[model samples]
Target: MSRAFTFPGQGSQAVGMGRELAEAFAPAREVFQEIDDALEQKLSKLMWEGPQEDLTLTENAQPAIMAVSLAVVRTLEAQGGFKLADKAAFVAGHSLGEYSALAAAGSFTIADTARLLKKRGQAMQRAVPVGQGAMAVLLGLEFDAASEIAKEAAQGEVCEAANDNGGGQVVISGAKAAVERAIEIAKTKGAKRSMLLPVSAPFHCALMKPAAEEMAEALSQVDLKAPAIPLVANVTASRVADPATIRDLLVRQVTGMVRWRESVLYMEAQGVTSYLEIGAGKALAGMIKRIADKEAAIASVGTPADVETILKTL
Candidate 1:
């Protein structure tokens, strides 16, 4: 059966995410070590033994999550004998997880991806001053309805839908006042619920234009190659493998809504019935189940034990 490998982005991070994998496998440990060397810091140390506040910072969380995801990929290749180029029909990730997907598909080296993410995190955080921007989840509303609500609530401010995460969940981002207005308008428009997200900045909105510009310059210096397998890009909600296109889309993704639900649907339409989440959490797997229904096969590969368990599938 054709399968797709997906990675989760921020908000899936937790203390001690890949600690077990590192302890149980030499390859996994090597992955962390390489990332540490690339970033010239012991990010794994912070991830394993977090102050919580620092680890949760966007700059730190982005690369840390990619490190775990790449470690999972290394384990699957070394121990599980599942070559990503051979098994997965497509690869995708949410937001920063897109870096992980690119790394897995061979568009970027693991070390390079780590460094890029660190820069990405910092760029995103510094794009808008804290409290000037905000994001919120509006549940029980279709994207069309949510878009209308966001536009209506904007009132000439910068409010826009950020993530369409499927299952009636849509995240909106922009100026704090506009986000607050959108929340109110969403509730009045019959949204199931609306609450401000505890995010440092309003990502994937017009306010992130500065961040997108930052990424464009940063990405230009990075070595990008065509992925061994196709990558379902976040911005376009379509599969793209060309290196130039990948680089361009990555910059655009900073201000583009994460069409996760649509990406999964696109993959499903392409005959990918099985989805493997190769990362710290089972979040993408859960989202796939919700988006694709019970018939879709889902798996999570976070540790060496999970690698061994998934060997039979290959």
Candidate 2:
């Protein structure tokens, strides 16, 4: 069966996420060590033994999550005799996980991916002053309906849909007041629930234009190669293997809504029958299940034991 590999993004991180994998496998430990060397910080320590505050920071969480995902990828290749290039039809990730997908597919070196994600996190955090921007989830509303509500609630502000996660879950981000306004409007427009997200900055909206610019500049300097497998970009919701297109889309993704539902459908239509989430959490697997066909299988690899278990699938 054809399978696609997907990675998790923010909100999937937790203390001690990669500790088990690192402890059980030498390759997993090496992935964390490489990342720590690249960033010159013992982030893995915080990830394994956090007071919770520093590990939760966007700058730290971005690369930390990627490290775990790549650790899983490296482990499968090392011990399971699994090769993504030979087995997977496509690869994708949600938000920051895109870097993990790229790195796993050999588009970017793990070190470069780590450095880029660190910059991305810092740039995103600095794009808007905290407390002036926010994000919220609107459940039970279709994307078109949520988009309309966001537009109406904007009132010349920056409210916009950020993530169209399947099963009627839509996330909106922009100015704080506009986000709250959109939440109220969504409630009136038949939303089952709308609540503010505890996020440090509004992401994937007009307010992120500055972050997009920053990423453009940073991405220009980073060397990118075509991945061994196709990557379904978040903004375009289609497979992209060209290095140039990947660079441009990554910049746009900073301000573009994550079209996750469409991306999953695109893979499903292209003959992918299974999805493998190699990361700290099962967020992408959960979303894929909601958007995929009834027969599609979804699995996650978060620890050394999971790696051994999935070997039977291959």
Per-candidate clash tally: 0, 0
Local distance difference test, each candidate: 0.91, 0.93
Candidate 2's TM-score = 0.99
Show the colliding residue pairs in model 2: none
Candidate 1 structure quality by residue, lDDT tens digits, 151-254? 99898899999999988889999999998999898888999999999889999988898889999999999899999999999999999988999999999999
lDDT of 2 by residue, 1-314 (tens): 99899999998889999999988999999999999999999999999999688888999999999999999999999886767798799999999989999999999999999999999999999999989999999999989999999999999999999999988999999999999999988878999999999889998998999999999999999999999999999999999999999999999999999999999999988999999999998888888888899899899999888888998888
lDDT of 1 at 67: 91
Task: Give me the candidate number with maximum lDDT.
Answer: 2
